[model samples]
Target: MKDTFSSAAAARQAAQSEMQKVDRGAATLSQALGLGRPHLMPQAAVTVEGFKPEIDSEDWLVKSVEHTLGDGGFTTHIELERQGDGNARDQEDVEDLVNDPKK
Candidate 1:
């Protein structure tokens, strides 16, 4: 995709923002919910609680919410993703570009 921003800074910011979105969307995560999270919704930010593993506790950007009712009663599921280091160099590039557009 491509766009024409009104200014150089706007173009830089748009590129940076797109990179961030790609970073966050690089992985798909799913969490089965027990209770106490009925309010979870798509596009919300969530953090792991209940002393999960450090990696499991990283903040997530909510992608979707699912609810199911079966013989076991009701259950909720959350599909999430997180910003990743997949674009570390891209980040540095954005920084360098912002700091020195001539680069």
Candidate 2:
């Protein structure tokens, strides 16, 4: 019937429009994440070390944290350093530096 044919055509058009919207959104997201262009060199494997945290050990102290964003995606690297000898003054200084409210 002509009604049935028109209904099928309308459904196809709606599906196509939805697909176009999805494609545009994907393209925008890829560009925003810096993946629109090809990378000159393939991304290297991410290496992580010293992630274990011990409640009683000094290994819980965070030495530094680094973040890298590229075509591959975002990667976070955290380095844990052992606490120095139980010196109260040094520990206080380190705590102050690490827990700076302004930072």
Candidate 3:
């Protein structure tokens, strides 16, 4: 994601802060629980109680939110993503899955 800032200094700060990411796409817990009312939107801060020590985290920030109203059901779908530490974290995730037997 990219944003426009008034000065170059502000842009640099933003870049430094968002350097690390956590991917939650394959994780079931991050899935949205049917939203009630149109309350949240993109860029909103929502707390997530994570599972792992350093992998699962509560530092979740809302990327996008969809609020819908229609006949019977919304009759549509949604899209969401969580960022992980680029490539290394992804490899770790795969290894965890393969080595884990309780899953």
Candidate 4:
């Protein structure tokens, strides 16, 4: 026996496949930028359930949206600026501190 499905279902499946392909391309681009993997990117964070960042200004949200949709998906910052302020904790540093016997 043969199975049959509606054209709409086929179209939906095709669209989903195309979207996955695009997401793969985006992930590849993201990794090439020294941004680690796509899952580590800002957009991935935004996808997490219960993840909501409360920026004080609409300007910040607009800037964020722009970055997510724009090439590189991030603002062009120099090495120094990208490192951020000295007072901010680095994830690696925190992990090292937690695991170190000396700490």
Say which candidate scores most in TM-score.
Answer: 1
Q: Per-residue lDDT of 2-89 in model 2, one digit per residue for the tens?
A: 1222344464444444443433222110112233322222222122234334423332333444556766787555443333333333
Question: Which order, best to worst by lDDT?
Answer: 1, 3, 2, 4
> Residue 60 error for model 4, in Å?
29
* lDDT by candidate, in order shown: 0.71, 0.35, 0.45, 0.29
Q: Give the per-residue Cα lDDT of candidate 3 at 73.
A: 53
Task: Please list the residue runs of candidate 2 whose C-alpha ends up more than 4 Å from where it truly belongs after superposition.
Answer: 1-59, 84-103
Off by over 4 Å in 4: 1-6, 29-103
Residue-pair clashes, model 2: 0
Query: Between prediction 1 and prediction 3, which has the larger TM-score?
Result: 1
Candidate 3, after superposition: displacement of residue 103 in Å? Answer: 40
Clashes of 3: 3
Residue-wise C-alpha lDDT for candidate 1, range 1-43, written one tens digit per residue? 2565577678677667767787787666788877536778888
Best prediction by lDDT: 1
The TM-score values for the models, in the order shown, are: 0.70, 0.26, 0.38, 0.23
Tens digit of lDDT per residue, candidate 3, span 1-103?
2466565556544443443443444332334445443555554555545457653554344566565666545422223345433442454444443344233
Once fitted onto the true fold, the runs of candidate 1 whose alpha carbons sit more than 4 angstroms away are 50-57, 83-87, 90-92, 95-103
Per-prediction RMSD in angstroms? 4.0, 24.4, 12.3, 21.0
